[model samples]
Target: MYSRLSFSWTASSWAFALLLVFPIIALVYEGLKPAEEIFQHLMATVMWDYILNTVLLILGVCIASLLVAVPAAWLMAMCELPGRKHLQWALMLPLAMPAYVVAYIYTDLLEYAGPLQGALRDVFGWQNSQDYWFPEIRSLGGAIFVITSVLYPYLYLLARTSFLEQSVSLMQSARLLGKTPTQAFWRISLPLARPAIVVGMSLVAMETLADFATVDFFAVNTLTRAVYDTWLGYGSLQAAAKISVMMLFVVVLILSIERYSRRKQKVFQKALTHEDDSRFVLLGWRKWAASLYCWSLVAVGFILPFAILINYARYYFAASWTAEFFQYSVNSLVIATIVALIATAIAVLVGLYRRLDTRPSTVLPSRLSSMGYAVPGTVLAIGVLIPFGWLDVQINDVMQWLGMKGPGLLFSGTMIALIAGYLVRFSAIAVGAVESSINKVSPSLDMVSRTLGQTPVKMVRRVHIPLIRKGCLAAILLVFIESMKELPAALILRPFNFETLATYVYQFVSDEMLEYGALPAIVIVLVGLVPLIFLNRSLEQAH
Candidate 1:
């Protein structure tokens, strides 16, 4: 009976995993089919531009993010600076500010007729366009800057954590050998932190590849924009799928490079002490420069855009706070809540299956389910519509054959599709959180429960669930936050007349009237900040 139950559980786990991964499978299948005319046209015409732009964007963002993040992370982790405590967490605030939001704010401020140029004209005593040259803020370079401003924190967080974990003795030994601080960092600290930094760079690269709103707003012809245009503008699913496959290729290449870079590299630190003596103290000019540099990132990334939103909200509150706004707020809340609950439940099941099953293949289900997180939102949306749309058609056909009026678009044209997309994109977060928590529970506990004749289900409910409940809560919050901020998926998958906060704000942004969307945009930022609190608390505990 035990063997039978175990086999049943294993089968169920595999089935669930395959179900989650089915969209990507379907996508690959569709993309590989004989090329439709639209796809062939795209390949012959503008596809090279798309590929080149995307590669450049990702490359620029990764390099710029590294330059910005590594220095800030090193300062926070290894140097003594005033306000370090507050600044450390504040550096992460920009993660809450969506790239599109920042893009709009900067464009408004730096446009030809905007205040910055207007003021420059006043100072230079010139009015016409030919008077002076200013770099355009709506170009690829601007997109790189805007994206790096927010995305640098991915590298900053990981690099900081790695730097914090390094042993003080290593730095001391380098210093004793007459190495300067910069030399020690280059020779000793950086090499050890390369794996962590590369992981951060891969994350930044993926995000740059996934970005649609920012790149689209800047008029950069990246593949994400190409996918969106091919699907919505041209109404060709096959073309969109083909473009999405190209993106997947880029994503796979990035992950492969990241993995290969760290394949044989491992650093184990003994005596991981971070006493004051280990820190390099900056004084006078250096102290001011470090403080200014860190604060500038926080200001440009979070404070400036956020403060502008507040100002807009203050003036436009009466117009922005209306029945429509409230309705969209409720819509966002309800959808995010549902996605969070369902994603968390799936995580618990997959995580527990891995914990209980001893076979090496047991890990595959978790991995398969987590793959969706790596897929760009635009690609995932296309992948989702293919399978669900077919299912909807089949359901209608079956109903019509039974002499009943078929329900129109049950899965594809309703909230179900949106929820499924969210699940595919964010279930990985819950799975990772639950797995981390479950790993902390000793195997002895499971053995003791088994010896007591507890069934796997009961043991999971009474033992593992209770132990990992905090992780479950964290997972729920993380998924909820991500779902709330998700724009591209929501934009693509939402049913007619459905408007989440992201989409609502995006509408105003697209119309160049972000003042009217300020309230909802602020809501997005504030809600996104919730996970950072949990993150900071975890880091503090680790410290």
Candidate 2:
């Protein structure tokens, strides 16, 4: 047994691991002061509402993603729908649309002054919202619909792969038993696909819990929105950290259920890749109807939002588009680019480290590092604050000792803070993508190199890295998309006078000016989709 870790692996491994673990520890430490304080706040005013809303949101997102993703995945994988080739890419396009962005777009269209109501007003000759009845766009149910519609891509991707790999023999047996196609799907295929659904749904559930932008935009008082309020409105990091831990508890439970559900299930073997020989050719009306449904889904998910955004972007040509705004965009691009590269690089090492080691310490680091993913962006924003404040204090003290002014606020307030925040929150995505791909690759490739007496580092550099290129690329794309769409953390952690598209939209929406927010909101959606396009393309080809 060589039992040797490379220098690059050791250093990069610990750096990335500590990068994730240290902030959480600091948060826990900061939060320890008043168990009573956070709890008291939780009990009196908003806890029940927060808890109830969070649960409903998670439930809604799960159901919605399943409805959209599972059927579409099955249809695409099992049935021969027209435009299936191009439609596959379209299905994933919605993944690029951020929840907050979609919420903004939906709210805009359905709002009293927006298109839908205006159209109704003209058609029915009604001038005010009071003149008629329509469902409120900002209500709990609306939040669920808006949020879930955009988040279902996770389910679509994972479930599609799972369905593609299902054994032909199993479905064949069901058909032989005279089960209808629909019955086969409901009974045989679905039961077997449960674990993959659980995996995909777990991500969506966490996403809903971790959501700050969508809930806040819809004025839903979920825990994530509460985390922001606790930290900013009251100046209480301890309270925020404690509340964050409450959300973390929910994530842990969902993950537990996921693990338990998946306990006996295995990723299907290659031999199980079955073609649907008895599958119905959806002909004439059914065929066109199926194609229409799939295409319409992509339309709502990708095209409609895009058209709306471009509509507002035209307004940008008349309004907020300026040299200064472009400069800020450049600044965002620079930080986003650096953070993506650094986080992905670190993720590669952590991913590789997992491949090489089975030690308890190594496994713990790998697992705990991903715990950041479960932390909502807003909670993570609060968690990162303790360290930043602590660092600033120590640095200022050093500056005082040097007979100079306090330490520069740049580290605490500006691009540095934003970059650090992105790395912490988004790196989990990067690690997941890289780790999945690494797992797919056979470890025997490395064994062959090792038997030839190549060093572990050399083995990775020459063998593992090249083979896992697709996974790495996918990971980078996922992280990049997520970072672009990030809202809660960026909203709270960004420096003075800084604005990303998400923050820009938030500023207007929070102020009750939906029109003011519409353009930037669209920009965010358009940008977020680019990587989603890449992600979906990767998924369709994953087989």
How high is each candidate's TM-score? 0.98, 0.88
Model 1 earns a TM-score of 0.98
Report the alpha-carbon TM-score of model 2 versus the true structure.
0.88
What lDDT is reached at residue 12 by model 1?
77
Q: Which lDDT tens digits does candidate 2 get at residues 1-543?
A: 236586667677887788787777777776666666656867697788888988988898798888878988888777777888788677887876766767777887888878888988999999787889999989889998887777788898888877878877777787789876678889877877788888999999988888887788788999888888887887777788888878878877999999998787765544757564545457778778888988888887778877776776676555666565576566657767777788788778887787786555666556656767777787777778789877888998899999999856746677777887788887877888888888888867777887999877788889888988988887776676677678788888898888876677677666756455565566666677677666665664665
Give per-residue CA lDDT, model 1, range 372-488, as digits (tens). 999999999999999998998999999999999999999988999999899999999989998999999999998899899999899988999999999999899999999999998
**In order, what lDDT does every prediction score?**
0.92, 0.77
Clashing residue pairs for model 1: none
Task: Output the worst ten-in-a-row residue range by lDDT, candidate 2.
Answer: 272-281
